[model samples]
Target: MSAGDLSGRRALVTGAASGIGRACAVRLVEEGAAVVAVDQDADGLAELAKTVDVEQSVVDLSQLNDVDRLDLAVDIVVNNAGLQHVAPIQEFPPDRFSYILRVMLEAPFRIVRGALGHMYAGGWGRVVNISSVHGMVASPYKAAYVAAKHGLEGLSKVIALEGADHGVTSNCVNPAYVRTPLVENQIASQAKAHGITEDEVIERIMLERAALKRLIEPDEVASFVAYLCSDAASSITGSSMRMDGGWTAH
Candidate 1:
């Protein structure tokens, strides 16, 4: 879509402070959408606000009560907030699993639930969920992350089905592994869990499933997100678009 395609549109992007979330926020704004950039990182949001005119919302997604309080009446919602804690299932902490689910799955539900009325009333909306390859498949020592993403995949489809008559679309963008702080931050945890060095975690673990060895850039994923919101993609609802560098081909 061009600059005016999303003119007068308003978008809410969670985890908008950095990484893929930041890229999506910037991309959407470039297309003339008024964006509400939400994240727990105040400094990072300040940095983003320096270059783009997006409303900043500094709130933790893990807090359900706070998530419900967010002004979610918007035309677009990008559910991208996430965290990773690598550990075997037997060793995984219960609280961590709940926390990840809260941010990745439950928070999206709340956001969409709150926004659907406005979208339905306006007869137009887009919900682009930033899911991972793990949403479709499995990986060791990532039970919570995998489960939450899988749940998101299901929720996206449900939203697409229910919102179809109202001119609303919901889809998931599933990337194999993007070069973002979330992936970088997980390296140490992955290394410790797999009993390997950080370098090995990238070389032997992260890239092993994909045919491409290089990590995907944030802009690349963000580009696909923007495409989904374009007029051209109005028919592409309920689909899990995999930008995984052929990772799932195996």
Candidate 2:
């Protein structure tokens, strides 16, 4: 499908309050999809509502019961809600690890489960998971985030395999460090963990593994996601598309 070809499509995007999620919501609306924006931040959702014609749901995704109860009968599902906790495996809190899994892995599973019936009946659907480079590679002090993202990668592939015969496609978009509030918040923690200055965190740490020494823009990732949802990407499923600026190429 061409840009703006989603005239009648319905989409549900989690974490749509800010950053990459917000960009994805805006891009989908521009493509003529009616977007249902979900996030835990009421103020952020309110702000997003002002800019786009979207239905809003303010709920914490880590609440597994609430996640399971969500209305997910949409043509497209973007599982993007996530959080980070910087600590080594031995120092990582058990509850925090569980919470990350709940939000980043289990919630997507629940949402997809709720939406699959509708998608199968309608004969079309898309599942786009916003994962990280950690989903494919390992790093220090990010045990929970890495584990959750890796689990999501597996879940996305399983969905792709199961939905293939039903016209539903499931894939992941893995990005490295993007210019978002999440990364900004991580700067201090990363610096502390690596025993480096904030400047070094960006230069010698974050961008060190990437061939391109720059933070990715949210819109850049969103544009790639938009392409994956189009008819042009019909044959691309069970794949992880990297927007990591060559981080994985190393």
Candidate 3:
């Protein structure tokens, strides 16, 4: 597609300080969209702002009221802000679980709700949720993340059905472990939790299910998001596209 395919469009991307969200913001900007990059990391946001022409919002999405108050009237909304807390259900901290749900599930709902009216009025919008393989299947020790993503999957489909007639499309992009700071930070914890060395964590735990034994790149996922917002993807809604390197093909 042409670089200016999305000229005149505006997009809101949560968790835009880094990782997949940052990549999405950069990609959309390259495609000629004005991006509103929202995140709690002030320093990261500052760096991102210098790299791209985007409006930076230093807001914590875990605060639902703050999310509700944001100006969400944009043509594209990417619900990519999420955190992972791994522990057995019996041992999981209730507060952490609640916090995860609030950020990952409730925040997305509010953001999408805030933007839908504008989308319907304009008769065009794209909602690309950064979901995970956990959205489709279960894995051990990720009770909250799994639950939130599954809820997001359902939410995306519902939005798809409700917005289809209005020219709005909602979909989820599920990727296996992406090479991001989030995943890198989890290496030590995962190794300890699974009783393996850190070196073995990626091969044994993260990439074990995938035919391709490597972590996905942030830009690769961003490319998928960009395509979903393109004219070519008009008919692709309510779908969960897997960039899992054959993980789900099993």
Candidate that scores best on TM-score: 3
Candidate RMSDs in Å, in order, are: 1.6, 1.5, 1.4
Total clashes, candidate 1? 0
Stretches of model 2 off by over 4 angstroms after superposition: 191-197
Model 1, stretches more than 4 Å misplaced?
1-4, 188-200
User: For model 2, where is the 10-residue window of minimal lDDT?
Assistant: 1-10
TM-score of each: 0.95, 0.96, 0.97
What are the lDDT figures for the candidates, one per model? 0.94, 0.92, 0.94
lDDT of 1 at 134: 94
For candidate 1, report its TM-score.
0.95
lDDT of 3 by residue, 35-118 (tens): 999999999999998999999998999898899889998999999999998788999999999999999999999999999999
Cα deviation of 117, candidate 3, in Å? 0.8
Superposed model 3: Cα runs more than 4 Å off: 1-4, 192-197
Alpha carbon lDDT at 86, candidate 2: 84
Q: After superposition, how far is residue 168 of candidate 2 from its true place, in Å?
A: 0.4
Residue range 128-191, candidate 1, lDDT tens digits: 9999999999988899999999999999999999999999999999998888998888777779
Find the candidate with the highest lDDT and give its number.
Answer: 3
User: Which residue pairs collide, candidate 2?
Assistant: 1-231
